[model samples]
Target: MRTMSITNARALIIMPAWNEEIAVPDTIREVMKYAPDCDLLVVDDGSTDSTRAVAMQAGARVLSLPFNLGVGGAMRAGFRYADRLGYRAAIQVDSDGQHDPRDIAKVLDGLDAADICIGARFAERGSYKVTGPRKWAMQFLAFVISRLAKVRLTDVTSGFRAANQRAIRQYLDHYPAEYLGDTVDSLVVAIRSGCRVTQVPVEMRVRQGGVPSNNPFKSGIYLARSGLALLLALTRKRSVLTKLEG
Candidate 1:
């Protein structure tokens, strides 16, 4: 793959939002502030709230789905948009403001040498911490995926990721909508399909607004679901790249 520099490449920030009307505006603002050169798109995953309208008002291009399709499906749509519009790279940022937009350029920089660059937490660069079963599950998943990708990854579940054209095409071919499929399974498939992967350490901040997905009590359930997701990823057939030429 040819090396693409964030300095010159046209990048798209793909924010997959679900009923995040409260957080999307601020997140969009921060992204614009930090990555003024890049375009922003919010994939409204069947949001019943004012997410799509709010995002559009906040100056982001919005793609509203008819119904909720989870992060993976939302992102597949985002990637298709990016590919169709001739974007050189795409960056994934959470809609809840957990991801610092300041690191967007850093993640994109990783793509000069890699097909996919993950913004990682718990990589000795941040104060963010997780404990109990969730921590264990994350560590296990990272360990397994690290070996597969041939890189030392500490946060495989992080949603803050950047992808070049190759990675974007790979994702459209096999990105799944099931639980953990967006983060784990799609990554496993991409790595298996010969995409290079790397990570940059990033600090995770508290969510600015909206309902949180995980609670302390649900850590055990997260563990089981993560393990099953990983198992399904490992056993699934490898993805064959479907070429997307502009």
Candidate 2:
């Protein structure tokens, strides 16, 4: 429910696409409708489909990587692009169309104070279903992150998030190169570097197209690996995420 006047257009919406040709257009159009002023970038992580062409036709600037870099690597490229281009802030939206474009504005409202703002579905309970093992996994990650962050966070694994320039810089220099490690470790690095983190309630939808990259087996593996990453995060040295002078 937090909001700020849209005085400047410094926000960039970044969608990381890997074989998401089926849903990319709708995702871009919905984002364009919701945040018309912001620039859109689709980081095509070497998709075999027409992802690059489709995104371009949908009126997005596409950054096609040489090969598949997975979600984390693609997102890192987006942040780097935004940083280099002098964008003040950026938002990461899923290309699978699972995240609601309408709720993007709500996350942006926290940018005035937060270095990064996460869209947490659990904040609203019945708004979205966590279901079974994924539910327990989320709780454990949230507990670890919140306790380390010294502030209560309801959802830590949620991909829907916003970041200011300082955060972009932080990720540019010290972003994790692993799978789910990027999302989990990047936040810890931001906090360790004294950057503000925040969360807002958001509703999520079932993915419209493209098979999920991770199955239940992969999810379990990710949870186990991410758990170890969290423990190591506690002792990881802080990266320089402070705002720099012009």
Instruction: Rate residue 55 of model 1 by lDDT.
Output: 95
**Which residue segments of model 1 deviate by more than 4 Å?**
1-8, 242-246
- Cα displacement (Å) at residue 42, model 2: 0.4
TM-scores, each model vs. reference = 0.94, 0.92
| lDDT of every predicted structure (CA atoms) | 0.90, 0.83
Candidate 1 structure quality by residue, lDDT tens digits, 159-229:
99999888888787788999999999999989999899999989899999987767877999999999999
lDDT of 1 at 180: 93
Give the number of the best model, judged by lDDT.
1
Ten-residue segment with the worst summed lDDT in candidate 2? 1-10
lDDT of 2 by residue, 116-201 (tens): 89989899643676565567777888998887778789888788999888888988877776756567877887888888888998
- Clashes per candidate (backbone, < 3 Å): 0, 0
